[model samples]
Target: MIDSHIHADTRPFEDFELMAVSGIEGALTCAHDPLEMTSFDVVMAHFRRLLTVDPERAARNGLKLHIALGIHPRAIPHDPERVIEKLPDLLRNPSVVAVGEVGLESGSEIEMDVFKVQLKVADELGYPVIVHTPRRRKAEITSQIMDLIDGTMDESMVVIEHVNRDVLPELVETECMLGLTVQPEKLTPEGAVEILREYGTDRFVLNSDMSSAPSDPLSVPRTVQRMKMEGFSRRDIRQVSDGNIRDLLKISQI
Candidate 1:
């Protein structure tokens, strides 16, 4: 099973060891808002360390790992040009799968500016993106991003994440992939199952969004179990758990 969007860099090493034992086959480890309070060099250094440690740890423990590098919207006072300048070189890493955790956190002008630049860069590089929708008024935030990306980017190449029931209609209107984060106080296992039942699993992926807050790493696995209990067939489960992301990962060139 793959937790498609996770801040693996934020978790302790033992947490990954636990994930390995829990049948989590792989994860896309995303860099959080390092630029929010840290220097660019510091952020880059952390990413560099994660790119090295995560894959090695995963490989040694029989788990697969991938990376997504970007300046998160929550990171303020960021130089979009600096990130754009460094992105090309970073994308060259074979383990890096996408450019993301990028999008509007506040739907502010600065956030939108950086989001637009990354969207353009990802489009130019032919890489898939993992977008972060705002916690408040996610529909509005997602709509804002779609508007920004209207002409310059392809919706199909993006994963608009942290979505929920309120934002479903807005997301369904686009060709982009939908991510359901199974974090506590967010989307529950039952809620995700209902979404799959109601909407079908096409262009959908599941994640635990682990290590961000008080959460459960087993959330994805638990969600899968509940889906099974709810009479979703193995093939249906596979589609959300692995197949959708497997297709997305193909764009990585890893």
Candidate 2:
């Protein structure tokens, strides 16, 4: 199984071992704003960690780590154009899979402008994107995000993350995939299973969204176990836990 979204740089090395031992084969670590104040140099340094430090650490612990680079909404630097210009070249790296963990946080004008610029970059590069929806004003902001994605790029190339039941219906009709995050303050294992049953497993993918905050590194495997207890078929389990994300990111099975 692959964790579709995670901030591996924020996790302890032991967590990777636990995830690997729990049957998680790979994970995609996305760039996020971890500090109170972010600068262009800081963002570039974080990207370097995602590319160089994090992958090697995960590999040593037995998990294959993939990277997704972008300026997260909350992490937007003073001069975003510099970061945007660097993305095309940075995204060409073999380990980087998408432009992600980017989208509306406060829904400010600057946030929207930066989000659109990153979306355009991803669209032109033909890379998948992992968009974020905040806990507060989720419905309203997600609606705006959907609107931005409508004609801007291929909806199929985007996966909106941290989605809950309230916003699930809005995304169902769209071509983008739904990211069901199982973690503290997000969906529980039981809730995730319930969603799979109601929504079916075609366009859904499971993730832990593990990061500096409280999270469960083995959330995906634990969710799989819940699905089994509920009598979900093996194929259905594979589709959500592994296949859907692999198909979206074009990652190989480990």
Candidate 3:
């Protein structure tokens, strides 16, 4: 199964072991908070290293790892263009899949500006994007993004992550795929099943989002198990567990 949205770079060795045992065939490791590092060159270097190191690490554990290269909104640099300037070169690398984990967090003007700029870049380059919606005022933030990308960005090329109950209806109105983070404190395995039951698995995909959270690496596989127990058919479960992610990766060419 493919976990569509995982910060595998932030995950540990044991987590990889757990993922392998839990039947995770592949995962997309996204660029997350870079902590104290501030230089664009320095940040780009770190992401480049990730492009190299993560695949080798995943191969050793018998897993396939793909990369998504973009500055997270909270970690957007003082000069976001400096990072945006480097995306084309990064996208040329075969391992790099999408442009994202980029979007508004505080819903601040600066955040929206940077997010729109990156969205333009992704649209220009013909790469899919993985957007991070705000934890608070999610509906407002999503609306803001939709407005910014209304003409330039294609909804089919975006995956809105960290989605929950309140924002699902509005987000589904767009053609973008929906990502649910299966964390202990957030959406449980049962909760994810309930969503699948209500929405079916067509535009829906499941993720662990285990980075810095109280979520387990095997959450996706566990969710699959729970869905089966809850009477989701194999074909339907595969749509949510693997098919939807595989289709998105194909669109991103990674």
Which 10-residue window of candidate 2 scores lowest in summed lDDT? 33-42
lDDT tens readout by residue for model 2, 1-254: 99999999899889999999999999999999877436789988889989998899999988999899998988988989999999999999999999988999989999999999999999998999999999999999999999888888899999999989899888998998999999977899999999999999999999999988889998999999999999999999999999999998999875
Residue 221's lDDT within candidate 1 is 85
CA deviation > 4 Å runs, candidate 2:
none
Q: What is the alpha-carbon lDDT for the whole of candidate 3?
A: 0.82
Clashing pairs in 3: none
Model with the higher TM-score, candidate 1 or 3: 3
Candidate 3's residue-wise lDDT over 32-121, tens digit each? 785744768667776876798767877788888888888887887776788888788888888888887888788788888888888888
Candidate 2: give the clashing pairs.
Answer: none
Top model by lDDT, which number?
Answer: 2
Candidate lDDT (C-alpha), each: 0.82, 0.92, 0.82
Give a tens-digit lDDT track for model 1, residues 86-107. 8889999988889877888889
Query: Each candidate: how many clashes?
Result: 0, 0, 0
C-alpha lDDT of candidate 1 relative to the true structure: 0.82
Q: How far off is residue 217 in model 3, in Å?
A: 0.2
Better candidate number, 2 or 3, judged by TM-score: 2
**All candidates' TM-scores?**
0.93, 0.98, 0.95
